[model samples]
Target chain A: MMRRIQSKALLASFSLAAVAGSVIAAAIIYAPEIKPVERPLPTSFDPGEVAKGAQLASIGDCIVCHTADGGRPFAGARALPTPFGTLYSDNITPDEKTGIGNWSFAAFRRAMVNGVARDGSHLYPALPYEHFTHVDDADLRAIYAFLMTRQPVEQVQPKNDLLPGLGFRPLLAGWKLLFLHEGPSTRDPARSAEWNRGKYLVEGLGHCGGCHTPRNILGGEERSSDLSGGIAEGWIAPALDKSNPSADRWDEASLFDYLTTGIAGGHSAAGGPMGPVAEGLSTVNDADVQAIAVYIASRMKPESALQKAASTVATLPRDVASQDPASSKSTIAHPATDTLFAGACGGCHMPGAPMQVTGRPPLSAVSDLRMTNPRNAIQAVLQGVAPPSGRGPAMPGFADILTDQQIADLLGYARAHFTDASPWPDLTAEVSAIRKEDAR
Target chain B: MTVSLIVNGQRRTVSATPDTPLLYVLRDDLELNAAKYGCGLGQCGACTVHLDGKAVFSCLTPIGATQERQVTTLEGLGTQAQPGILQQAFIDEQAAQCGYCIAGMIMRAQSLLDRNPAPSDAEIRRHMQPNLCRCGTHHRIIRAIKRASAVLGSQNGKGDAS
Candidate 1:
């Protein structure tokens, strides 16, 4: 009986040990190890530092994504659409219950640098931590301080709707390992401070590459072809690199002007995605603009020198045609036509006068005459330009004012005088076609 | 609650619940339509206005806090006949498209120029960074500011009136 009792006791001990071992294994498998991180806080808090951080945060446009469309600022609820699924921005506000209120500085740093959350879960690149990694620790701390002061809301963002197979989470560990870098790398001290500053802003807060640089199928920026330009949300963020045709068209002054104002004469205007960037840069300091310009200028090749030289030469009629056109009969006939034009149209169409008539484009910069296609210009003249609402009244009908032949002559004169290009296809049929189309 | 304030050098009164934003008071009550309601939350600067000559996001400014304080909207800045330097510069540079956020941008730039007559590009970018324009006209906006700076600098140093 004693032997049987001892055997039973041994079996019972073995069973308990087995159960404990299984429990330990389950815990290891379910909850992986999260390494502890400690960061050194600054010796003394500086208000200026926090202010600078606020400015940088603004430059990065952190609030746009963190804040919901109609919700409280930084009560993060912005939904980002991705290939895998939709991911909502988490509440970064300092609400202990529902937000990152209790997170340590080290935890915040890790999130910005490594794309790892406080819980050690990998965050998707949609948050743009890849670019944030380039941010300095001091700036990061300042941003943290600014965020802490913001009123925290109790709103909890909805869970991301990721694809089923992609929800394993461990896969992100591998992705992060490949793409994400830790901090701003050591700079080559040889470069000018201006160039370095530009580099930092472009790669870090400006995140110019985020939109300007094309991405792969996985949404990772193609490192091989940086700043080559890319299509984002229907607008093309043109190539900012040296090879762009328009880059040479605009001088440094024009570039600086464009970045600050969103318009540059004789080239193009900022629109779509570039508009926000201009708005953001408009807030930035002039030194930074100079630095950015310096850096961009350094990248450009001298191949555009010829193009620049060519632009300086005058191509207007005076330079192109040496003789007084009045010496020729055809030219003399043009003055007679001009007399008629002056009598009929000089009162309002003269330069420096407001276009009183609605729907009539400013005759000064009307692209229709300059563009390769003259159809729009002819149509406007035949139909008489209708003014858009909120602008002013429409131009009266020119259909009753002049014959079709006179209208054509006026168009020819306008094109020849105003633009370098020749007359486009005859508009007699096009005008009729357009009127018919409008009727239909 | 009734809040009495000075707007564009004129005294005005507005009625709103204390919690209502200054943006609503300006747009809804005063009918000063330049300040737009973009993101509603201060993420977009489309609702920026000058409060006591400082640029602030009007959407977040509480109506109760604006009592007896000076407020200025874009209309207060200048008219087409006699535009402020910044407004004129904007026109010369053709710095608007849909023009939804221009008032805010102009106000922000006006504040920047008021403080510093000749702000470096970096300073301009830093100060104007908060305003978000989806139209991507940053290049021209920067140019207009620089142009305004030059124009203002050349003038006899009379700061932005509004």
Candidate 2:
């Protein structure tokens, strides 16, 4: 009886040890590792610091993503759409109750560099802290100072409308463990200061890769295809790196001019999401813009002789309007489309026309249909160049004037006539979608 | 709150919330009717005005933000007897279709020309893209800008005839 009781007690103790051991292991794996948030706070900063911060923020393009459709700037309520769900941006204003007014400098740093929030919760990658992780201490401080000085808007961020199983914030911990790369970007010793600066800006604060580079199923930037181009904000941000199709049109001079002034010597004009980016870049110093241009140019392979000759031909003024409709009708495979283009586009796009005197760039020079996505071209046609910039001919939109079918036909005809590139396969569907939205 | 601003070379004080859009203050309080409310959001160019010589969307800009800055609306640009060069050019080009977005377009164009008196067609298109005009008068608008540039250029003793 004594032996039996001793064996039973031994078994009980063994089970207790196993349970405790499991608990300890789970704590190590599941619990957030708390670090001392020791960074100092600033009560006030000088004008120079504030100015530097503002410049960094501009490079980040913070305002475009943070501001909602009608909400105040930086009072984040912007519903950023993702494949998983719509994530509402958090307000970064200095409001004590609802914003980051109470967050310590260390907390802000951790959030910026580590993708962790003030409460030790993992932040969604939607904030682009993955790229921000590369920001150095001084520049980050400057940005923080600039943000803190802004008017404290008393706005609470709305709840994220994320799809089920996606909003489980705890899951972000595992995601971070798998993919979050933390640390400042080290410069290559072989590169020049200008090249390094460009790389730092383009890769870090500029976060150019966030939109310009393609994303994987997990929504992270596909590193292997960096700057090869990606679709962003519903428009195809054309490739800036080696895969660039129209490399001949974008020399260093033109890129610098485009970045500084939002126009590339009549070769193209900034439109869609790039419009806002150009506006922001317009305010930056000339050297920085030039650096960006130099870096982007370096990424591309030199244009071949054939490409140069083809581009020259493409840019030449073509009289698509003057051709006799009766004679040219047989040459056009899509007669209806040809007719639509002639009636709607020929008046101003043709040479010597009244509107052409306004310095209308030839339609042949326009690379509107070259993008993998048809959104820009479709929107341009639907909206017309309603906002006429000085860069190119602002064609009036035919949304109110033409049917979706007619517009599709017109676009198809223009694409067929204009470039050597393949036409958008779903042209009709794209036009219909634009029409359904009423070109808002 | 009371905000003081230098509008079109005039000093004015107005009562409004701190975050109230500058466009409302200019239109409602200052009685400057030239800048129209197109989108009320920054997306439309209808409420463009020169904020310290830079063309910015007034509808998106808060009144408090413009306290020490110069705000130039269309009313300040010129009058019937002595219209501003850009405004006169717009008239000559007949750039106004419905005329709703013309004020904003001209203000934006004025800012552009102030910076670059003789901008290329591409430069103009890129700079003036932020302002939207619903009417298909973009060609005429561009023409008016060029004409304004020429007039200003000749006045400055440098003109691009090409």
Candidate 3:
């Protein structure tokens, strides 16, 4: 009789442990649904707060990913390609049927901080909550107000095309558990107030590290090597630091020019995904932009380079071309490449080209030409630098006309002429690889 | 500084800054009046010419880069008395307004015809996109290219689906 009693007790204990385990698993993977409120009246939000939210949203670059090409702003359908699969953006417009119109401030905050939706499902980390979590409640509130007042557009976002098994939202809970560090980043007291603000904005809304920092196997930014250089939208977001491969060091003024105008002469132009960021920052307040430059320039070098202002004009290559008695001294006896370069790129790139006279930086001064990896330069050749807005056309892409081998030869010739850096090894293979990647 | 280039199948050398744009070389030094100077920024194709048998903006190509390359201007295409097939087609179609962009339009069209003997309407438009005709004579230019293509295709006895 005593043995039977002990066995029954053991069974009861096992059942209890199983119940506890189930509850813990549920808590980790599940979030309680926030009650949806009625769409608030636009007038309910203060005008000043709305305007501030507008500025913050610009810095956040919400529209860049949120809006589909040729679609209404904030009426999301932008396809963001990931290693997992493609994920469409959510509509942030005030449409009650399709967007965040009924979302309470609490729901919005939860989504931004925890990558959770109003309906309690886990959102993909592609939303960049890792950075948004650094944003304070007050700023988030302002952004909420701004979004709440937007013109409603009744557009349903397309379903995410995640890999099989990965489509299950519950799996994201584990990812968040491992990577998400919810709360504000600590302010550095040793830094100036402007610098602190810059840090806050950059780490929070700018999310510079999302692109500038390397990612691990799970696609989480490697926090240990923040802003050291990473790939974004298939283009290299070069290290904004001493490790930056550009010929010239970035000063605050140059950084400001680059961040605001999308191009800083003698340094680099903001191309690919970075173009929109500059376009967005151009609308921001000058003082705030200046603070960002000050902080980023300091973060970039942390040395005397920051103190010295970079020259706004690019002149070195032009000077060299004027002084160069013989450009035929290229060590490579490549006549085909020489003719191709003369016809294709010589118009803008040759030393005496009018582009040089207009202060367009010569290829030699560009970091792409000097980088150990030639992908960026190859991309530049293939795609060209597209302008940020509808203002003007940019460098014409040559992918349609120039063959991969011809491009390789041209670049080989350019490297020999423009930079002392070692010629890009197996250039045709690299160009072909990049083309395939871009196509994918 | 002196630079040498083959112009219209003739080897020509001129004394100028090696960095001087080919547009200035062809115009100022060689006295070839075919390629014009419009937007020196390469946006406008007014200074289009064939370098090494490819259409390039002479305004942007430095003389130094043109060494050992065949530079052909509209003047090289044909004289006023006898015009090239493409030029004849343009004249027949009257594909010019102010005539500023005509020389560039001809050179650009010649490159297309050389590669794609018979091109579709879309292909012609896409190829001619880089060069701008401010006079709104694109339809005429398109017609001329098509006319030239048909003639060349018949002459070669090779048919292309266009």
Which candidate number has the best TM-score?
3
Chain A TM-score, each candidate: 0.61, 0.80, 0.91
For DockQ, the strongest prediction is 3
Residue B70, candidate 1: Cα error in Å is 48
**Candidate 2 structure quality by residue, lDDT tens digits, A1-440:** 99999999998999999999777645533545344433224456777988999988988878877877657888898888777888888888777777778777777887888777777777899888878988999999888888888877888778888878887776776666566678777787887898788888888888888888898887888888988887765667788876766665566666786776666644566666777787778777888777787678777645354245444633434445445544553236565444344444655555565554554445555556655667778877776543223343345455544556666776777666665567778788888986776433
Segments of candidate 1 deviating more than 4 angstroms: A1-45, A183-190, A265-267, A300-440, B1-162
> Which tens-of-lDDT digit does each residue in A250-351 have in candidate 1?
445556766765544333345444555666667767887766666555554353563563565222223212223345333354554443343334334444
Question: Worst ten-residue run, lDDT, model 1 chain A?
Answer: A313-322
Which residue pairs come into collision in candidate 2? A384-A397, A386-B133, A389-B124, A389-B125, A390-B124, A390-B125, A391-B121, A391-B122, A391-B124, A391-B125
For every candidate, C-alpha RMSD to the true structure in Å: 20.4, 17.2, 7.7
Would you list the rank order by lDDT, best first?
Answer: 3, 2, 1
Quality of candidate 2's docking, in CAPRI categories?
incorrect
The deviation in Å at residue A422 for candidate 2 is 4.1
TM-score of predicted model 2? 0.63
Over B1-162, each residue of candidate 3 has an lDDT whose tens digit, in order, gives 566779999999988765477899899988998899997767878988888788877775667666667889999989889999999999999998999999999999999898989988878887887798888999999999999998898888776334
Model 1 alpha-carbon miss at residue A273, Å: 2.9
